[model samples]
Target: NLSVVVIDEAHHYVGSLGASFQGLLWRLERLARHYHARPVIIAASGTIANPREHLQTLTNQAFVVVDDSGASQSERTILFWDCTRDPKTPPSTQAAYLTRHLIRMRRSVVVFSNTRAQAEYVAMAGSDRSHRILPYRSGYSAEMRRRVEHELRSGSIRGVSATSALELGVDIGSLDTVVLNGYPGSISSLWQRLGRAGRTDLDALGIVMVGGDPISRSLLANAAELLERTPEHAIAASDDTDILTRHLLLAAAELPLEETSIEDGPGATAALSDLVNRDLLIKDGTTYRSTKQRPHLGTPFMEREASYEIHFQGTRDHRAVERISIRQALREAHKGAVFLHFGTPFRVQRVDSERREIVCIPETEGHHTQPALFRSLSQGRILEHLEPHPTLGIERIEALVVEQVTGYKEFDQQGRQVAKRKVTSPIISSPAEAVVLTCVDPIYLGIDPEDLFAGLHALEHALAKVLPLLTNGGTSDLASLTLRNGDAPSIVIYYLTKSHPSTMITKVIHNLHEALSLAEHLIAACSCASGCPFCVLDARCDDEVIDKGAALALSRLLGKISVGTALDSSGDEEG
Candidate 1:
């Protein structure tokens, strides 16, 4: 019997599909009840709001909680540092920046990037200037990651940057300072990642770098407030069904599954027998087995990989092959090549072979070629037809994604939402509900041809210090996006469409939207009198400098435009 339980990355385990461990969080709660032990859960996170509630939802038990405020309240500084998006974050620059601060400290420092790619990049740059600084991520073989962890323990490695893999309960000895290139997505994630910085003998010195993304900015700016705030945790429903179902079959595979009355479930015995008679379960004496005839009777709900073969189209040859990632496919797609695939059946909109991309908006249901995730968010499912101005776990959830927050919002002396600026935002993406959409782009994309060239260059500079925000889904998926050049030519946009329905698509669109909007919003809100912090465009990129009004205008237009079918070069929809 375990006396204490510490759920490190506690924010991750809510929905049914999140992780198998999520099931464990639920099961542990049930086990506690079964054993009549009142569980105590102490969760630490970066800026995830409502720690206690998040706990309650996961454990299914009501409990008391304590909150810790990091000592850096007055010193919790946020900087709007600038860098090239192509990630010209030089090792020399990073090393110089840190050496100035922690060179004197005894313990080392840890840097975090959400993705393996960025983590590798930052680690490489740092190691070039320093001695024995290592890169830690899961992409490397288990041995490689283990070696990195081992090095951290021995102190041969002076500094390290890693993916979220290191954010959990792994011990990396003690550290002096922790730096984040951007605000981690949730409060819990933030604390957990930062917790690795300071420990035992040293003070917990954790610093966060906000990527030029809006979400990152909000998380960084209000993290102290967010950290100090209560977290709203939700529980997954009907989790025990899987447990009962699995054990029932396990028992059938071994011995006769009968209600011994010791099992406490009454109708379970009759239910299994009835299922056998109905041809759902096959009874071989006291044991029951799923009918081979039913094919999927004993299958797991989340269809494991090897279920489908992805086919990606080659731009140069116009030949369809297996699915590839955006960074690879976009560079390869031929100009004006058509993008199509079969995740859930989707109608092709437009394709850019040149950009190696596709643009699509969701079509009403035809054939769900890609699987439809359960719409887990209330705003997406319940509150439709209203412009949402959500507080982002603040005063209230109004907009799904906030663009501009206003109305001089003031919190009373009691730290409540008294009155404040009515924050306007784009419908924000929810971590819970994952939705799918189809989009298309034309031959030249026609949004702004030159900006297409320039924006790519700009993004590298834009996201220099920003965290990679793949909120809606994964980063390797196909995507469609609009861009602008400095009076070089008309604005152009491009998109890549994949037929499969995966979270990758959502991640692509959300990251693109977040990247452009954060830059545009900060630029527009600031390029005014006194350069308001609210709109300081404080992020690294000065999108407004490139085309201030145009960027904001484009972002707003995207929010309002209803998604439509993609138009072929001749402006005809693909049949």
Candidate 2:
């Protein structure tokens, strides 16, 4: 019956966050509701452009305004050094530089890297610092991570580099600073990590190192917009039947979860029992359990260890528990070294692959080595223009593109190794499915020849914000591609999810006709046989952009479209 909840990374579990953000969320909500608990959440996510309506719908409750706190310190001080001229400003180098810089100023620091390998690299480089550098993340044996935390608390560590595991409130000790190596990719992430700083008796210092991307540029530009803007808010999820169904089976593993019991959310207990009527659950006595197969917690990503165990000279203690990953292990121990464990400067002589241990000895030299791969970011150039060629199509004139990615590839898709692509991005413009509504003029800002690419980048930023809403309901894939005519250009979104385009075909057709009806009043050129930007669209459009004005008219014409989904069916879907 816990009414209060704190949902960290709420955005990650939405219907359309990842390939299956919705599926995971449905499971979470189903579990909560089954126990007669509804969370009034203090939810967290990256920057939220819209908070009020988002949270109200997300949590399924009438939510009132709470403290919309500004970022604890300066709006957000982002520094972009010109690294293209010198590739030495790699994540690892910059991480070490930030730590040393802070330590020089007598401040404690945390380095947030995008991956575990990078975190370990940074930690290894700073091994000799008196405030020992600690590598923290989810993958290390619970024993190892706990030991790391203990050293941090004792001020035996100067810096702790980590993955997202440290992003939450796992306070090892208060630090004077935090250095974000890359954009954490969301508003909630930025603020939550920033919260790690300013925790000391002294005012904390915060620094964010930017990766080269349009999103990163936008964040750097509007560093203070949130100062006058509302605080980032959260969005919750509705119940999902798939999750409920899964829980129905798992509930049997604990105690019989009977239909008509008072444990389910709202009217869920009775609703769940309908499955028994359908023979999904078998009723015995007053309780009902799954008629299906057994529940599998499955194997964890790595060797599962005690969540909070630390061994010190054969003695052990416990700390926070979390999932371990390959990324976390590499990030924490890549440049494995031995520092003073109990008075002696330990040496990590070599890493044993099979044992997952770094062979170490007392340090023979003054310095330990953590190799860094330098990548450049501060290649911030102004946008020139867009030129179209029939062969290459539309190309960006000037933009900040990833020139050469020099790290080990972690995830590979379509044969391109992830995080290793020498990605090049132009001030790109693509088309999105539009609604024909002219009620509000779409906001357009002038692009200086130099800033044209930046404008395109800002749109890229805006599109990311808008696209998440459409695909987030959970059952789908979200992607986009570029669409350009001989003269015009736009983006074509391929949103494949639970949303079926076939279902709304009729209303879409009617709205298109309404758009055609308005072409005469809107413009005569729209009716011309020759190609013109303004016109009514049919099904097979090269650039599938629906006019917003025409769309709103159609929306008013269609009224509210309700999708009734039963969350009590938790049976998982087959591919």
Highest TM-score model number = 2
411 Cα displacement, candidate 1 (Å): 46
Error of 1 at 292 (Å): 9.5
After superposition, the stretches of candidate 2 with alpha carbons farther than 4 Å from their true spots are 1-88, 129-131, 211-222, 226-233, 236-241, 248-279, 282-289, 292-464, 473-575
Total clashes, candidate 1?
A: 101
User: Per-residue lDDT tens digits of candidate 2, residues 189-209?
Assistant: 666676776654556666766
Estimate the TM-score of every prediction.
Answer: 0.45, 0.49
Least accurate 10 contiguous residues by lDDT in model 2? 392-401
lDDT of 2 at 258: 49
Per-candidate Cα lDDT values, in order, are: 0.41, 0.42
What TM-score, to 2 decimals, does candidate 1 have?
0.45
- What lDDT is obtained when candidate 1 is compared to the true structure? 0.41
Off by over 4 Å in 1: 1-8, 17-56, 59-107, 211-575
Cα lDDT tens digits, model 1, 1-575, are 55577766565554333334444554455556556776666665444555566566555566575565443322223333332232544322353245334633544877777654345445543443345456676534566668777877787766777778787557765566677765544445666776675555555566665444444445544544555644333333322333344335444443334444114463355556556766766766555565543333554644232211223333332433343443322222212222222111223345444444444433333211111111112222211121222210101111121122122322221223333323222121322222221112212223454333333333332322121232311111122212222332222111121222233323333354455555555445443432222332323233433333333444443334433222223322221
- Superposing every Cα of model 1 onto the true structure, what RMSD results? 17.3
